[model samples]
Target: MTEHLYQPILDHFKNARILCVGDIMLDRFVYGSVDRVSPEAPVPVFHIKRDLLALGGAGNVVRNLASLGANVFFSSVIGQDESGRMLESLIGAEKTVRSRFLVDEHRHTTTKTRFIAQGQQMMRADQEQTHALTSVQESDLFSALKNEVESVDVVILSDYGKGVLTPNLIQDIIKHASELKKPVIIDPKGRHYEIYNGCTLLTPNHKELAQATGYPTTSDEEVSKAASILLERVSVQHLLVTRGAQGMALFSRDEGPVFIPSKALDVFDVSGAGDTVISVFAAALACNANLEVAAHLSNIAAGIVVAKVGTAVVKVSEIMDAIHRDMGEDTKETHLLTWDQARDKVMLWHQKGLKVGFTNGCFDVLHPGHLKLLNEAKSQCDRLVVAVNTDRSVSALKGPARPIHSEQDRSVMLSAFDCVDIVVAFDQDTPFELIQHLRPDVLVKGSDYTVDTVVGAKEVMGWGGSVYLVDLKQGYSTTSIVAKISSGSRN
Candidate 1:
């Protein structure tokens, strides 16, 4: 499937109105560089550089939904402290999200402070109270929910084991949402899933699932059995388990288990990945997406968030780009780009100081050889651009019998590989013009060609770039495979 297939779904996201209720907190990150050990103590001294503040817990869910272009009503409780004031101000700044906060004078606002050095967290400090809300606070929160429950399309319970999602509040929210025929999605916390009974769906990580069901959720079979038990115990209609690297699994009573693999290639920080999952899932439900589509979209959104450094939101444009990168066909709208789009992308990468690598091939029939070459090429640079020969060009060079697959098919196949970041077809026999226009930081080719014989190597070298010749995998060649197939030989 191509990204164009998701355009309609994305359009629906713009019209969604989501009600996000749960624990809200503030996340603070202090970035610096570790120099030497402190003279007063054994700790390393950090040279303070900068600091950042963002939403945390349920607040992050509101941020994610707003960033995805949803109209969000966020309700949570915070202390009447400085941190609480700061959190309220930040929420007010978002035009798409409306805040309905209940303040408690007895507690301090939850704050998580992290010390990061060189893009890594050195230490963390947290200040929070896990006790349930006061009677008055619970009543106020429920009143707010009752007022907004009828106006929203979906309700999300983002539980961080914080005090806002009390048992009574959860029950009331579920009942109200169900009465309004609005789906309720819960980002569950704690060992007991019974508190979230009657909710439409519950999203739990692998560890949480194990704790809730008391079953070893190490394998799919165990998870399936455990989820089945939890389903019977709780009133939820569906269970979504998010496995860190293994991806996510969705279980419902009516349908068999559906698993969507993780789309993340490079995971930086998984701080707020759960918030992203729930936010996207709720937004998709608000847009009337089916259970399977909602899960798939949420999986993609989670994949994009985990690749970032901290609690981050996935924008609609970013989601579209991810979909395009993952499933785009060879059409002009996809990875098979025009010269203008290619230039813009290259320029963007250059502005970011990213190393771009270029390699060209006919790729008539994809085999292990092509995979090896693309993988090696991508390893040498931050971005890899594959320039494919058009069908006419391939026929002119390798004869009419060559290129069993059309240019569109070949480009689509190459774009499907994770190692190939961008695919562009060239009309000429060689990608000389394409290489010159791209001016990639590195030029790559197979070991079959020397530095001198490689196409566009001199031009790239003149521009202070270098050429890389990856060693070919022995006994594997496209020509040999084609010939073998034609000769009906079993090798």
Candidate 2:
């Protein structure tokens, strides 16, 4: 698909009110370097250095939803414990999410802590209770659902099988959501797919699909057969199966299956990727995206999350970037930049120890004089940024009929040159403010103008950068070419 395919869907994510009900847990990662083995055990001892904690499981789905700018009403069951309190605080910290936690005093809140060293996972420890919720706790949860199920645009059932989603409760939740005409998307867990029968969409990874359907789902035919069995058995509208390296398969009752390839650059951890998929998918559908479009965006989000080292969340920009790259489109093009883009590009170049050069012109027409000056400018620095005047500014500086070429055409032309690393447009009369904003390493101008007379020369000098005056190619100018064309003369 082209880059424009998902723009409308992405634009609809902002301010979407979603209800997420699931098993929320806290995930803590301990990072440190391991050099020697421990004296007590044969395995290497993990040295505790620092910790990074984030919402996981259903909480991760809420995090992804909130991170994508959705206002989420999230509910889950937690123990009356410190971890539960911390989970409460974490959920409260998110400005967009309103959380309701039902406490079971006898249970322990679920938490998973992983130890890492040099980008490799060492060990994982878990603290939790997985038994089904009691009558009172379930009743409390149902009460919360009663208050939220009718109001939200969409409902997400994030089932880690950690006891929040019981069979009867699941059926009731789906019934209520169906009555309200809200789509329910589930990131399912355990072997029971029957409880989520009425959900609008159900996401299960390759392994989960295989286990739930009792089919060997390694090959394409196996996956298709298994997905068909699950869809027919569960009576759901659609099923999206996420295959890690093999990509994703969408099985619809109307349309059999359409597969999307994996867009991940690398795979670090696959822990919370399923959460990201369901969250993005449900969010897309919540904003009125079709099944095909939602699956594509969700598959893209899943690919991004698996590349990270922990239970991670993906950003909207990251998803858009993957879509553009996956479709072989250049989103940034980098050849043309706005003033803000110029500043960011220069900052990145400086961080890499590359010298940046700056020069400005209308560049209405390509000429040997302009090429010579730009070449000299490039030779003085590692990256040469050519600032072209906008159409309005060009008209202000060189008269309305002079530029001959639009700013876009002129900028695209400059970007084609090997010497020009970056091309930016400026509407101002002079590039003095832009130069000061960028603070490039070198300022370039034609030899006709002295350093003392050149604009931004003093600022460049003040910033410890040098100025260069290139020897212009004589008898070659845009004005001369225009005059020759007007006179119908050939040299």
Compose the digit string of candidate 1's lDDT tens values, residues 286-359.
87778888888889988888876567778877677778778754323555876545654664555344778999
C-alpha lDDT of residue 378 in model 1? 96
Candidate 2: lDDT of 465?
A: 80
Query: Estimated TM-score per prediction?
Result: 0.68, 0.67
Error of 2 at 166 (Å): 0.9
The candidate that achieves the highest TM-score relative to the unseen native structure: 1
- Where is model 1 more than 4 Å wrong at Cα? 1-5, 330-491
Candidate 1: residue 323 lDDT (0-100): 85
- Which regions of candidate 2 deviate over 4 angstroms? 37-43, 333-491
TM-score of 2: 0.67
The whole-model lDDT of each prediction reads: 0.85, 0.84
